[model samples]
Target chain A: MLDLLRLLSFGPDGWGDEIAQGALLTIELALATLPVGIAIGLMIALAKDSSSAILRGLGNLYTTIFRGLPELLTLFIVYYGGQMLLTELAEHFVEGAHVEVNQFVAGVVALGLVLGAFSSEVLLAAIRAVPKGQKEAAAALGLSGWRTFRLVTFPQLWRVALPGLSNNWMVLLKDTSLVSVIAISDLMRQTAIAVGVTKQPFFFYLVACLIYLVFSGASSVVFGKLEDRAARGFKRVGGH
Target chain B: MELLHAIGDGFLSVVGHLGLNTELMERYGPRFLDGVWVTLKLVGISVFLGALLALPLAVARVEGGKFLSRLAFGYSYFFRGTPLLAQTFLVYYGAGQFREQLTDIGLWWFFRDAFNCAVFTFTLNTAAYQSEILRGGIQSLPAGQVEAAFSLGLSRFLAYRKVVLPQAIAIGLRPLGNELILMIKSSAIASVITVYDLMGVTRLAFSRSYDMEVYLWAAVLYLLMVEVVRRVWDVLERRLNRHLLISR
Candidate 1:
């Protein structure tokens, strides 16, 4: 036990600091991707809900393509394909300018696109679950469309969307491990490096798994509380 | 073989019309086909084996005694809570840490192969997800269905085999399809451990030519596979639930 502690300790002889940094980077990547994914998902949801057939078709196409493709494949496309495209643009516009897509940015965009595709489904369901009469009542009160959505629809959307979105967040948290493939020093990659040096693959990988479990377990608790808070002031209709 | 050749020619002609690089396709096309076969074998074997393991685990979760239920719960929870990639690493590389003990047990050969490790890890991982799906399907049935089976002079095992499982499976078909699709996508991670699935071939092809089009082709192939599965699953679901449909 003491040997294990020393191996995981934060000093020249140990890998604790590197693993800690990797854990922080993993959290940072997930946090950075959250708003981008949610915003894109919201737009896609609205697009699917729109009256225009073109907009609806485009939304369906986006979700179908992104959700169908593997997340690793998406990452490769963004990392390599995005770099290729940017380099071409840069060379064309500015004489001999070089461009390399940042790994962190590529990870965020790739994972965000995937999360958007999935969350749109959840968000679209929640948007539809809001009673249509609420909007009509708001309109009858002379409220503008935006005001009606803000005052009446948005509040209830959270209550309905929270559980599905929480599930997505857990998935996103796990998917962040894939970014380690693109040479980002996320927790998984850091642990891999530690395993390489220490020759203790089981120890390091098991530790990595435990860290991830802690994050996910904490997330479940936090989301549970959020669901409760969202449910406050709403009357229970049927079951206990 | 002649029919396959004809299909290949037709595909090449389509690629030509699309103005894609035909030379790249000509060189890497066979490799990609091989990759597809590998991917299919990986997902197919693992999902089938996983489902087998899952049925019992699901039964344990929903119908077994307290000790069995808790054991199943812990197994499912551990696999579900962590990233599959991490689980893969733990199994693949962690095997090295136990080389001596495994050698003594004469099981080192199994862990020594990357493909075997991938299959084993994927089997365990998908079993957890599948068990949860099965549990949900089982629990979702109205309680009276089971009671009716018992009241019909059917034994406990007979009731489950003849009545409960069929209904649970029918209810769970869509989710099982979704799970299969997810497994197809997740199988790509096996490439990181050197399994040469579709993604592995794409990576190798990319390193050689550095052409972005290879990834595009891969994306198209994956999309086609997912679309095919989705359509087939839709038809199957309808067929299975035909009795549930209201008559026009």
Candidate 2:
């Protein structure tokens, strides 16, 4: 019913460019943060597995705090809290030195931290899914820890963990839109701005929804295919 | 010392303003409590409604009815795929665009109330998520159980309600609890549209105090609420699953 082309014009007045850029930023933010999340997740799983009581406590506390809080609210804390910390750091680290984490950097860190907390659980499960016998057998063979982990543990861990990690990635992607709150100009925020300028809340918001749907929809298919590829080894060799 | 002094002053201002606290208590304290009551009412109603709506959609996915199933699949795809904030804004502000036609048909009354709007949007959002979990849980059920139920002359409804639903509940509780946590957080979004829960109080406090600390206090309130809710839900889930003797 509404004129769709005029609604999405790439011109200065047309939000086409901003919305498109927002979509790109959302994807990039998610992709950039996945490694941080995965790495932190691995460390968390390790900590949870550690014999040290303090390590176990820290691991438990990390997941409990991050997972317990709301993502939207957490974004606010990071945007503000991270600024306070960096400013506090600047006073000590550099004489009259100033370093600022912009909204985008703060966003990536905040979202990734949250993602890391959730991803840790999935990683813990994945790591455990690797058989105990393999570790024991590797120890019996007198292989060094690094070789045993690299050769035996991680390969299977990746296979067991790929689906969950990808699922976390999709969530990370969608939640990046939340950072638009601190005015990172990501897709949803950009769409809201476009709606404000165009005086067409309905049209712009609907378009934003469609954009998210398309992105996540494509990701689901891709993730499913990846899972299938990961499982292909088992299929060919006969069932686990 | 200056920052510490500023913090001390902020604490003093908050504490010394007994009149402010008293005034807030006098004016909207009941209303705030009512808001909490309404939120509980909303979360309870929406979760149940969401679960109910999810069941048919989940069953359709598992059953694979041609046209209707495809329609359900599309519904889940569209709803689950979109962000909840986008949906909230669309329902509250975007739906206002069609008020004239909606009013002409007398549907305006339902849409006019912010609470109804919140419940409706929240129900749809949670329904989509819950349905996927339900579908997965149901699929996880042993096929032989269905056969055994049928072998005992149980009808589909009885078999599902007694056999399938119980197991699905146990399987689905964690995800469902996660959804409930999400619903609590998302309720704060409703404050943007004039349904004051907690953040609404933050706005009011900021206007009066003109301080960022008001928002800070609000954030602490939210953090505390989330922590309490998390512990409570963890206990409830553990209680529910005690029959299985599995440690979560």
Cα lDDT tens digits, model 2, B1-248, are 89976875675567557434544444444454565666566777888899889988888888767987898889998887887778887887776778998899999898888778888888998899999888888999999988999999999989988898789878988888888887877776666567766656555655574444544555556567667777898899889889876653
lDDT of 1 by residue, B33-111 (tens): 9999899999999999999999999999998899999999999999999999999999999998999999999999999
Q: Count clashing residue pairs in model 1.
A: 0
Candidate 2 at residue B88, lDDT? 80
lDDT of 1 by residue, A60-176 (tens): 999999999999999999999999899999998899887989999999999999999999999999999999999989999999989988878988998999999999999999999
- For candidate 2, the per-residue lDDT at A152 reads 78
How close to the true structure is residue B69 of candidate 2, measured as C-alpha lDDT?
80
Model 2 steric clash pairs: none
Q: TM-score per candidate, in order?
A: 0.96, 0.83
Lowest lDDT 10-mer window, candidate 2 chain A? A231-240
Candidate closest to the true structure, highest DockQ: 1
**Complex DockQ, candidate 2:** 0.42
The local distance difference test score of each candidate is 0.94, 0.79
